[model samples]
Target chain A: MGLEIINTLILLLLVVAALVALRVKDLITASVVFGVYSFLMCLLWAEMGAVDVAFTEATVGAGISTVVLVATIFNLKRKSSD
Target chain B: MKNTSLIPVVLVGFLLFYASTDFPEWGDPQSPASSSPVSSHFIAKTGVDTEVPNMVTAVLADYRGFDTMLETVVVFIAGMAVLAILRNFSRKKPVKRGHEVSVEPDLIVTNTVRLVVPVIQIFSFYVLAHGHVSPGGGFQGGVLMGASFILIALSWDLERALTRFPINRCMVVAALGILLYAGIGVLSMALGGEFLDYAELEKVLPVSREMARYHAMLGVEIGVGFTVTAIMFALYANLSSRGRLEGGL
Candidate 1:
């Protein structure tokens, strides 16, 4: 029950972080925050016993997607105003 | 950037919440996944037929071999796409204007990353090699291996790094990997029992069927690993090196 409560809290925090990411003006920081959101989602998946999907999400989402997005940032100009 | 869509967002969230209600309880041993016909078959026959310790690998290499082959093709296509994009645009001269300085330090903190990279690479190989008896497999290990190169790229100059590992060679290796996988399948057909049937190869190779299957699976896994690792690094290189040349402006 304690673990369940903690998981719920963590999920709530992730939702808040995602909202912040979406509302943020800086594209790069927002992308990084989105990556963090993906990682938190992976944890939620694992907690739900979807181990295989969680594994894919953690690797592809946190690892590959982050690298790709960071790389993409090099090609674009920084600081987009909302 | 600040378009209001609160109703749609709330509706989507509610729909997702509703869908979660139908899902099985977390970690319930008697959940449908554990009790399903497919899982039951896997649990029962995996040891009897494959004799391999890892059930996930048995399913991936033996039962779902066709899907694995197509996945290798997808990796090959990604490598080709990266090469095409990089060759056309990446090699073009950067438009020079004035003095631009890097915010990040050019030199790494120490040799720690360099020292750890080989260890990580070795672990990835171990994961790929022991996949038959372990949880890791071609796809997982392949990405881990690819990450080593990305690390190197991060800590070093892109121009010098490209010289050490050219994108064109990576593309060739990726293509070769897919072809090698198909070649093995064709070789199996030539030996007798349809394409990709390892049992037939066992009969021709004078080895036990189980051992032959193990060897064949290893071959395909290596192919997948190489193709995936190469393609992933290629994409990383192309994406990271845009607008930068051999020497900084």
Candidate 2:
């Protein structure tokens, strides 16, 4: 019961973080927040017992996808007017 | 690109959420994944036939060996694609070194990182070698190994690290790995069984069926590891180069 409560709280936090990311003006911070969102989703997948999918999400989603997106952002001109 | 377009994205997100409603609850023992015919067959036969502790390996290398072989070719193709892209468009001149930056503070950190990097590399090798017996496998180990270089690039400059492990050489090794895997498959076919059938190789070698299967799996796994590591490294190099160019560093 306690574990269930924690999982629900974590999922709620992830949704909130993702919304914040979408609303943020700074593209870089938003990208980082999205990466955090991916990490949390991987944890949720693990909690749901899809270990294989969780593993792929943790590696590809959190690691490779984040790096690629961040690198692409770095190549673009930074602006506060997102 | 507009807020209006995001309506579709929002709808897709909600659709995914709704789809999850039909999924079994977390850790339900009676889930189809746990009780499926394929999983059951693997669990029952893997131990008796393969003598391998890792059931994933038995399924990947024995039951679906053909799929694994083609997956290796896909990885090799990806590596080649990166190499082609880099060769076609990268700047010809070496990136100019700017005015001397302060090295004293960063020196200590770099030295410490350099010390730990080799240990991480060793651990990746251990993961690759023990994949047949453990939870981890070639893809996981290969990424871990590639990540060590990324750390080196972060602590030190990308240029210095690129000097030690040239992207071109990584590409060559990746292609060679695929060739080696295909050679094994062809050898199996020549010995009278269908392609990638390790049981046919048993007639030529003095080893048991289990050992032959293990050997074949190791060959393909090493190929996968090489191809994935090389392609990942290539992607990082290209992305970082683009970053440096746009950032004017």
Candidate 3:
């Protein structure tokens, strides 16, 4: 089904996003990637008919969390210590 | 070290996949969750009891109100904790960093944001008010509202944003939100019903029991929105300024 393909693609991208968020040395890049991961998860939730959860994911997870993370990053070293 | 860690990660990933196989298929009617008496009861009676089209909102703001109240409290406490830890009250000059430079906000960005902020705030209100019939509710709406303020901070500066929404006012608004939620519960209780029994609100409002619940849910959501909006901005303001509450990203 078309829905299943979109879901599968999103899931794959989620994995890539997650891996990139971890692998990236730049904290700002990682935070932005995490936002992408959250948005993909939101799409997955919406696809599965959890609209309320998806909304929360889009707003809190993807939106506010990204801004907050970027704010924190600016106040600290931009690069990962490890 | 990273390569060695990947072994455990891959193993855990496989273990999760193996564990998930035993779970019921998605949306299976015969699944334990789908067939549970509680879910069935909610699905069957939520409309009758609350007159709310959105069952998720009904369950969150009415059925599980106590839990949501505490969740709001948790958000408030987290903001307070961050403030306590990071807020700088000592009278000392901030050391100028290499990156710290006075710069004016970009004209194009400010103009674009000026046009966008009002729409975002109004949309957030729509999301909050229309939650009973739609997918959104307090948390999503409140986050959107807070983000509007953060956008102002981003486009302009923290001082300009704070001038609109002062830090002390933020705390007052956050606590008042909890008070409003609990006050409604107490009022319903005072009207000869158990705590948070919104049906008792029928005594005061010229509406039926179900309608009373519907309106009460909206009130509860407003309380949640207030706390979440204020605390969210407060969190960003304090965190970005390292509690000095002046400069921002």
Interface Cα RMSD in Å, per prediction: 5.5, 6.0, 3.9
Give per-residue CA lDDT, model 3, range B46-164, as digits (tens).
Answer: 99999999999999999999999999999899889999999988999876555656569999999999999999999999999999999998888899999999999988999999999
**Candidate 1 TM-score, C-alpha based:** 0.82
Predicted complex 1: DockQ: 0.34
DockQ ranking of the models: 3, 1, 2
Kindly indicate the candidate among 1 and 2 with the higher TM-score.
1
Order of models, best lDDT first: 3, 1, 2
Report residue B59 deviation for candidate 1 (angstroms): 1.6
**Cα lDDT of model 3 by residue, A1-82, tens digit:** 8999998998999899999999998888888888889989999999989999999998898559989998888888523331
Q: Worst ten-residue run, lDDT, model 3 chain B? A: B94-103
> In lDDT terms, how accurate is model 1?
0.75
Candidate 2 clashes between residue pairs 3 or more apart in a chain or in different chains? none
Q: Write the per-residue lDDT of candidate 2 for residues B1-249, one digit (tens) a residue.
A: 578988998999999999999999666768998789877789888877777788877787668877877887786776566546544454675443342232333787798888987987887777678778875566766776777776666567667667767877877867776776777788889999888787777887788877887777787777777766776666676676652422111
In model 1, which residue pairs have backbone atoms overlapping below 3 Å? none
TM-score of each: 0.82, 0.80, 0.95
- Give me the runs in candidate 2 sitting further than 4 Å from their true place: A1-3, A48-65, A77-82, B13-34, B89-105, B243-249
